[model samples]
Target chain A: MNPDLLPLALGINRVILYSGYVLLAGTFTFWSLVWPQGRKDRHLLILSIAGIALTTIATVAGPMIDIWIAGMTWAEVFSPISAAALFVRLAALAAAAFFLVDIVNYPIASWRRALPLTIVVAIAATMVASSNAVGGPWEVVKLVATMGHVIATAAWLGGLVALAAVLIPRQYLAELDKVIPRFSIIAATSVVVLLVTGTLHALAIAGGFQELVTSDYGIVFFIKVAIFGAMLLMGNHGRKYANGVALRAAAAARASKEAKINHDKLTKGGPGMHSLAVAMGAELAIAFGILLTTSLLVFVAPH
Target chain B: MSRPQYSLPNLRRFLGACVVTAFLVTAVAAYYGTPEPLPASVDTTSDAAAATGGPADQAPATVTIEPEPTAAGVELPSEGPGVSEPGLLLIAAPLPDGTWDVSEQVMLAKPTTSLTLAPADISRAGSQFGFARPEATSVQVSVGEQPVVIPEARVIEQVSADIPSTTRFEISYRLDGATVTTVPSTARRGIGAIMPVTSGLDPDLPVVVMVVGETVLSLSCPELSLSERNCGTAAGDEAMILAEPLPFGAAVVAAQIDIPRL
Candidate 1:
């Protein structure tokens, strides 16, 4: 908050932000291995861990270098090294965004599993983006909303995959019973959160409606909205699939019981009963694409 | 069949490390980088109240100006070598309206040259300033410990602030006659209201007024915004003359003109 170290503080802030992203990625990376039957490739785990460390280092470098550049009592302190550090960190944030799509095991049917990762990526991008405008503290708000949007999209898509591909393919009236209702509540809540937080982050970054459509930043935003709208449509249909409401009553009743058993098994870390992994994977892949664009958005000037 | 769940030692450890690191960094910045307040020795311009009862009517600041024999008799061309030798460094010209300074204070240890300007003929005010000079007058002298590499040598209209350039009444170093150069003292602005520093000098000695050009004047309200200006009690302003011509042997070495209050 001190003005004297304003440059350094900004630099540090960037570092702190990157570290948060790595930690986020690390949690999921760890969880992927932590679960039973998950792949235990030591090499992959090392790569993930190393990515996190690089991200963390990039975040820290932002501030320390800024401080060094702005600091020192004598006038002879300026040099090329500090400028190089800042450029490197910015590039790191962009790289971290790309790795979000590249890193990790995208589990098939559990929308719940994808939710946290999505939110983390969103928040990280938001932090990197907002760093351009509202620097000098108070930028945390944008990060929060961005993270929320991320979590929502992940959960929405992941859940859709769970319903259509996993639960539906089982073709057992039994599996639909548990998957539909549970996913219903999750999708509903996630959608609401997504709408609210997305609106807030959008308004803050775009600096209001005029800029939203006029600047290059605005065009990217418009594209993002189009993708979001399409996803929403996919999700509404997804909800119906999860609830079995459109199915014959007999099938719905039988599906209800199957869903309950499936829930119990999933909670206990047992193998999945539904065959919805492909659907969820498709949803995730689409979401990942959106996320990369979002990463690019973070770097674009709001004008 | 399972042990009771408990606290996350890892989470606690992370938080603890963050706190410790934050404290350490803050402490380091505070210790080494924090700047102390500068003392008031040099920056008294902000405190006008302490500088004066306004401009002093009490004569001018005095200073002891001893011209080395090498510089003596160089004021008027009629009194020294013909208008063709070195600056003679013998002209003991004192600066006008200098900040309170000391020769031993490590500030005035500089090589010097002098020039004079006035109506070339007494019948005019600010007109007819040309005079004849032998081609070799006013040679450059290296003054400081730093070796000065002369990049260009010529009498040009543009005057450099860093290099010593002066225009005042200068007599020939070898001949006993005066000759004014095409160089006119081009000093701009008036005496800054800031109390010029004065040095100790014997009033009995002559004070030489070495001007940059003919006459210099600074009016308060450079943009004409202020109603008031720093001038002497002469109706609208305070009249500040650099040197009152002294009797033949006596010279007025220096004077501190009160700047007009803008």
Candidate 2:
């Protein structure tokens, strides 16, 4: 309610939103790349990707259009449609996130298994969000951005969980070796996507740089970023081990063995794969926490 | 890796059921809720007039003003053009009701000529003008009524006993600001008179005073032709600062003397 605290609140919302997106995107990238079936199954990718993409599109697009309209001082455009666009975008993002979570958890062969739960969760989340509707155009923008962040997270983190706990474990060390490299490629892609998407979302929803240092939302944003920094460090280590050292050893063995031998020195045991999976899971869990906070931030007034 | 999976049709059914349930619950909450209500008198006044097809226009009304003693009776000598005015103006009389013809003032309401006097005054004036206050009064009038009211006839009061000089006191009234003047006199057998000037109070404004061993003085000055009307503020407020008389002076005079509604 305090005007001074508004920017800070926005910062918090942004931080959580970004954190969630990274987690979600990373999760999806890892699993889709790691699983032999997933890498081939574009349908599987779409189960989460479609919703997340729609959310991102709406979130990113709605605000830009609104601001452009405002900058033009065209009340005819900004005054009415802007707020509506924001809400529609918000709903899409939340739906995308809900679907993303479900898709990430979807059993390998049948996406239909996750649909019902996703439908329920998406509706419930939207309703709780609806219980706290944003009154003005800015609020709509904030909601959409928050949604993007959250959905991305569900895709990266929650999806990663599905990959590590469900997909990677079914394979032995050799298959794990192949899967780890793919997971590495996907995770790396997700991290970059998350960071970029997060920054854009923060800028639009919080207004500008002024909100970053001057508001409570800004402070919370800083904390989320700090957590994200830790997540990045952890992801980097997992990526290096999975992609750099171990996968190379496996590739060397494969090349030599068909000509000849196996590679044991590269993966000491299953622990490397297990550890990556666990790290990814930790990342996902953290992302979910961010989602919860972003959801609350979306309900608050922005500066 | 495989965990579990279900068909699309089943998922669709689940979603439909959840949406329906939430909708029904929300509808129930809205249906049971109530809104607060507004005040009764406000509703009655507005509603009754609207429902009844306009207010009744036949209500009679009246207004009664205290008689002013021609307080500014400044008898200007129908003077030579620009002649010096008199020095000791005692009594001053105000302009008559026919002055500026200001009754043409615009108003949201049609102000009626209503009898506005205490019940006892209406009874004493021998006219039962039933209206108690100006706002509550109503009177029938064709549109474009002018001068509002015309004086019907002045009332007269008769004294029965001989007046004693021993019980009298005198006060002088200066009027027309400098020359016109009047000497105070006691009530005589043929007519009743009001008290003398009090602390330079306006004579036109309402006053309540007891004439010694007689009925209290009350006068109506709808014309505002009185010396005291111009003193300052209300005649009633200034009367408070006036010097009181010895027991021999006329009876106690006060404003706002309550009369029985009947």
Candidate models: Cα lDDT each: 0.34, 0.34
lDDT of 1 at B210: 28
> Cα miss at B170, model 2 (Å)?
56
lDDT of 2 by residue, A1-303 (tens): 221132243334344434433433443444443463453344445434543554455345433432231111122112232333334434434444444444545543345534433442353244224222233235665565545544445545655554544434333445655666555565556566667666756665456878655544465566677777877776666556555544565577678754233455444445665676676666656656655555444432131
Leading candidate by TM-score: 2
TM-score of each: 0.32, 0.34
Candidate 1: list runs displaced more than 4 Å.
Answer: A1-183, A242-278, B1-262
DockQ of each: 0.01, 0.01
Give the CA lDDT, 0 to 100, for residue A155 in model 1. 50
Is model 2 an incorrect, acceptable, medium or high docking prediction?
Answer: incorrect
lDDT per residue, candidate 1, A112-177, as tens digits?
A: 345334434533453434233232223576667766665555455434432343333344334445
Q: What's the true lDDT of residue A208 in model 2?
A: 81
Q: How high is the DockQ of candidate 1?
A: 0.01
